[model samples]
Target: MHPDRYHVTLVLAGRPALHGWWGSEPIARAQFTGLVGRYGQPGTRITLVDEETGATLTEWPETS
Candidate 1:
């Protein structure tokens, strides 16, 4: 992870990895990882829909 660049990466337990571009802060990444870790092995999926355009942005899968 680069301190100067902003990115979000989600490691799924039994699924593929997901990466996103956002504010690349260590704290941000850590927080996200922590949140996901609390849930258990990442196999859960989430669909992020754009309310205005009704478009899907990204789908996240839980990881172990």
Candidate 2:
């Protein structure tokens, strides 16, 4: 994987449903959307955070 790529994961019930790396910020949204589209369902909530900064970026509903 490239150095800039980041692996984002969706954990459901303490288990991971999806995991992949995003190359850049622009792709983060699309990558997140795709992962959510595949694994997100009713009552599905996601927590987005930065591993390096230990900051909580965004946390909300994962489904449309």
Candidate 3:
């Protein structure tokens, strides 16, 4: 796996977030979408980041 790729950080209240990395944006988004579709609720947030620079790439529900 590339060191510089999109990753998902799942935020849950009163619990540590689960982190996973993907090889590309599309795959990451798909995985995240599927996860949220199955288990996410209000206040659940999906964070996307760049593994190499540690920069936050995007956040779900607010694509801007």
Candidate 4:
């Protein structure tokens, strides 16, 4: 399995504040939820991306 294939990021005030990488999608998704709950506020953005395919898995405050 590819190591750190899933990338998660938390952006605060238009800057990257936190990030993580996981090989498992499930684990990355679960952590994404936690990050949202813990940092879900105005001006903060949370995202999960699949590094293998460069596809966005999910994001908080999704774009319209």
TM-score of candidate 4 to 2 decimals: 0.95
In candidate 2, position 32 carries an lDDT of: 69
Off by over 4 Å in 3: 1-4, 52-55
Instruction: Report every candidate's CA lDDT.
Output: 0.46, 0.60, 0.75, 0.96
State model 2's lDDT: 0.60
Model 1 stretches astray by more than 4 angstroms: 1-43, 62-64
| Winning candidate number (lDDT) | 4
Clashing residue pairs, candidate 1?
Answer: 6-24, 12-63, 13-63, 13-64, 41-63, 41-64, 42-62, 42-63, 42-64, 43-62
Q: Which stretches of candidate 2 lie over 4 Å from their true place?
A: 42-45, 62-64
- Misplaced by over 4 Å in model 4 are none
Which clashing pairs does model 4 show? none
- lDDT for model 4 comes to 0.96
Model 3 local distance difference test score: 0.75
The digit string of per-residue lDDT tens for model 2 on 1-64 reads 3543444667777676666555565576677677677767765556555555556555547225
Residue range 1-64, candidate 3, lDDT tens digits: 6843888878877464788888887888787787677657776787778787788777666655
lDDT, candidate 1, 1-39, per-residue tens: 333244444545555465444343445456455545554
| Residues 1-64 of candidate 4: C-alpha lDDT, one tens digit per residue | 7999999999999999999999999999999999999999999999999999999999998988
lDDT of 2 at 27: 70
